[model samples]
Target: MSESSDLVMPDAADSERAAEAALRPRHLEDFVGQPVVREQLSLVLEAAISRGNVPDHVLLSGPPGLGKTTLSMIIANEVGGSLRLTSGPAIQKPGDLAAVLSSLQEGDILFIDEIHRLARTAEEMLYLAMEDFRVDVMVGKGPGATSIPLPLPPFTVVGATTRAGLLPAPLRDRFGFTGHLEYYDDDELATIVVRNAVKLGADLTQDAANEIASRSRGTPRIANRLLRRVQDWAQVKGNGKLDLSAARAALDVFEVDQRGLDRLDRAVLEAVCVRFGGGPVGLTTLAVSVGEEPETVESVAEPYLVREGFLVRTPRGRAATALTWQHLGMAPPEQSDTLFT
Candidate 1:
């Protein structure tokens, strides 16, 4: 049996990584969903190109798998510039950041994923680089240390973060534009699944596409993953046809329910409802009850539950809504109203 962690987690496996790369949209026009963001970003890039100047710093904030990294690459493409991909965690110090910043060629787009997690010193260094296109490099050591100003070529910083709230205001304000990506609707995910099916050279029916999309938790990455799984099941168990039956059978084997709830998601709801009397329970306590890390529960499970109207996060604690009771086939207590109120 697969570990419980494998059920709903969105992390891509090694094999899936190559598939994702191949399915990625090369240009902004080919990208799926986020219409408002796409339009605004197009304007930003177009305006910059017309003026013959690098575009203003941009921040793309959204949940994982919603295509922030892809959009960053598109930004570079739209402006006809090269892209430098890095992550906040990889920059451990100011010097580390300086190396990347100083090496940027003119019109390059520096895409820093999880920008909110950047080290304080590196973040501070970025402020000057973003604003003035220069960095004060430290020379010598100790008391005799001198600062040398290094001029950087004009470039754009495209920052992507899942937690925009964690970024300091100064850092956040450095970006001239911030695009907040929301979860894709079922139709959008369906389109993404169909596109990926074509790319994978798999025969997928419309009903099967809808089935995978509806159970993808409003994520393109999950939709593609489910599509691949269904395709595999069709090849092995069926007559190599991706139809509704194949999709349903594959999802059932993977323990993904009709509403996209996996084992871990159900566990969270069960823990809150049955184990805690429908839970005005704290996140830490709830995570402990489910035998999962608090961060995992908070970041992964809770977002979808709350978005689906199955759970609510209050100042007090995490609580299951009435819909959660119905989904689990349970009756709410007589005092359940007061419990949430």
Candidate 2:
């Protein structure tokens, strides 16, 4: 069992979001990691500035907490444009999206996070808007409906999605540039932790930063969140300094393992290794066993587990790897072919 509750999830809560906002780098140069993305984006912004025109629409695709939102905000800042934030789930209807688009000024940026989830109608409306800078707004319903074309000011759409493959080809084609962000490496994550810790007023030592980074699962958001938790521990229990000892103690208190597994992560592994006899269990069954939604299991826990070689998706279902049993401190069952079924 994990030493703490699932409420101590890696997902940023409101407070953590406030910390993230404050810690976000305003310029591309200040942003750490994703060197390839940063360089390409810099060229795009520079070319637009030289031409004295709004840059082309950008699509940023990556896993959650990889700085897509930060990049979008940076794009607006570099271009000297105001950013209007919205999400695919927010635009329930075409009118909802139209309302947002109509409000944009020349040089303004509309950042749509989770854009792959946009409704079909909203997506079609966006197709026209992106290419022609106009939308045919339907004013009436039924046979009396009228398509009144509304010309929008020239602006840029920065779409961020965790599932870029889910985007339709037509919609994907509309974007001028797509920057796929990769996970941060250990050294890069350590730098990010050290830099952000200073902004948060925590006296984090280099070794402590490295410790946090090693356990961060190559994600900056988790690194910062853990640092904040360590900061809390240091201020209250330790001598108000984030050193190696304080870092390890704080992480233990928060129930984040050395590999960055939290309560939810452990739950999935335990379900597979213990209850299901090392799995080949269906996703729904696995989710039910862990008392979490299927989406939570598939999206939140499955990715990292599979990526780290602890879980594998088989035709039969999800099976546990040898590493999973070892991670759970359980004896590996007999080498059975069924485990791979």
Candidate 3:
């Protein structure tokens, strides 16, 4: 079996950073999926622009690779403002956040990715900055310390998080708009694949695009990545064109199954179904059996599995669904119905 980390998971790699940036949609209209979010966000930005004021602080929460960062950039562009990019982990102290906040220009968009991982002190400092457009900067040391109120420009903050539930209520409640991005459907993903292929100057047929979309685990990032791989295969193995055959062969080489289950995905499913008797197994236990971290199982693998109806999370533990047994070509036990129930 391949190592879990080798799987074509949704997490971004350092090498793909430039490619992702290049593929990002410049405007909300160009964004392929999340119709409701695109419309609502358009309204919000337009309303703010009409008033000649900065938009409210926006919060975008969803799984990785769903374009939170891209939307944040779009928000900045639509508002005709500069975007300052940073992450939660980068701001280890309140001073770090204060420096960034104090440097902001009027109508600037501060995009903080992984906002849930922000340090508690930094988070508290952000509340005042977002709400009052000011930061209470402490000067001096010990008992002689004094808070100097620093007024900031009216700016918009676009916060992105994979785990929105981890955010404190104070921070969460400060955002005027919170958009939760859902995974893309196959049709939506297919559209994204075709658009990306055009940008890459690759020959991708509709059937080829559909094949890649179906095996992309319903994520545009994955769909584009798969298309790139298929393009390479087509160039070397056949004519320099991406067709259904080229896509299938390339995906097979990469160990992506018909149902889009990569090696790690299969490992998780197998561990749950075979090792744990179709499991009511705990997530940690299941992760252990598959030689992975519980976070990897939960964030990377399990979301797709559960979304595809191959797995279930019961209060007792993680369990396999009837579809899982069928996918594994196993006849469920007599008590399988009770397990699901």
Candidate No. with top lDDT: 2
lDDT for position 275 in model 3: 79
After TM-score superposition, the amount by which residue 130's alpha carbon in candidate 2 deviates from its true location, in angstroms, is 0.9
Off by over 4 Å in 2: 1-17, 338-341
Ranking by TM-score: 2, 1, 3
| Displacement of the residue 169 alpha carbon in candidate 3, Å | 1.8
For each candidate, what TM-score against the reference? 0.92, 0.93, 0.91
- For residue 169, what is the lDDT in candidate 1? 99
When 1 and 3 are scored with lDDT, the better candidate is 1
| Per-residue lDDT of model 3, residues 170-244, tens digit only | 999999999999999999999999998999999899999999999988788788889899999999997988999
lDDT of 1 by residue, 1-341 (tens): 56866864545565667787888898989999999999999998889889999999999998999999889888888888999999999998999999898889999999999999999999989999999999999999999999999999999999999998999999999999999999999999999999999999999999999999999999988898899899889989999889999999999999999999999999999998888888789999999999999999998899999999999887889888888999999988777632444
- Kindly give the number of clashing pairs for every candidate: 0, 0, 0
Residue 109 alpha-carbon offset, candidate 1, angstroms: 1.0
lDDT per residue as tens, model 2, 247-293: 99999999999898999999999988888888789999999999999
Q: Give the TM-score of candidate 3.
A: 0.91
